[model samples]
Target: MGSGVGMGMGWMWLFWVLLILGVVLLAVVAVRAFGGGVTRSDRGDGRMSQERSRARQVLDERYARGEITTEEYRERLSALGEDR
Candidate 1:
């Protein structure tokens, strides 16, 4: 009878732990679904900035390597709307 009681207590403890974990998981999902827990940089604006920076870096590399003429580089840079 003592062993049975111990087993029941152990199962109850496991159930409580699992219930808490499940509740935490649900809260995380709800926050993400509602866009409540994310910052601005985690959205599309940061991605756009990254892409523009990458493009400018590649353009600078190509210009340094003499793969493009100064005139062509200026034209492309202007097209990318980046300042000199």
Candidate 2:
């Protein structure tokens, strides 16, 4: 019983470490996935408009997937100047 309790404590510490590591990994991935501080100059194209185009494409895909409503898609597309 005594040794089992000690093993449980060891597992508790392991859980804490894993939780912290998971959070750090998620933060990094989220930043990169959202294109944190990414600029068009970073792309060889020298034009930032391509970034907007990609974002618009993603929005359209989401709209087609029914993840966003028609009104919401229109609003966002208008904001991105992709609308008539």
lDDT of 1 by residue, 1-84 (tens): 455656667579889999999999999999898966777656766897788889999999999999999999999999888968
TM-score of each: 0.47, 0.44
Give all candidates' CA lDDT scores: 0.87, 0.85
Q: How much is the lDDT of residue 60 in candidate 1?
A: 95
Which has the greatest TM-score? 1
lDDT tens per residue, model 2, 1-84: 455656677579889999999999999889988876556566676556778878898998999999999999999999988786
| Model 1 residue 42 distance off true place after TM-score fit, in angstroms | 8.5
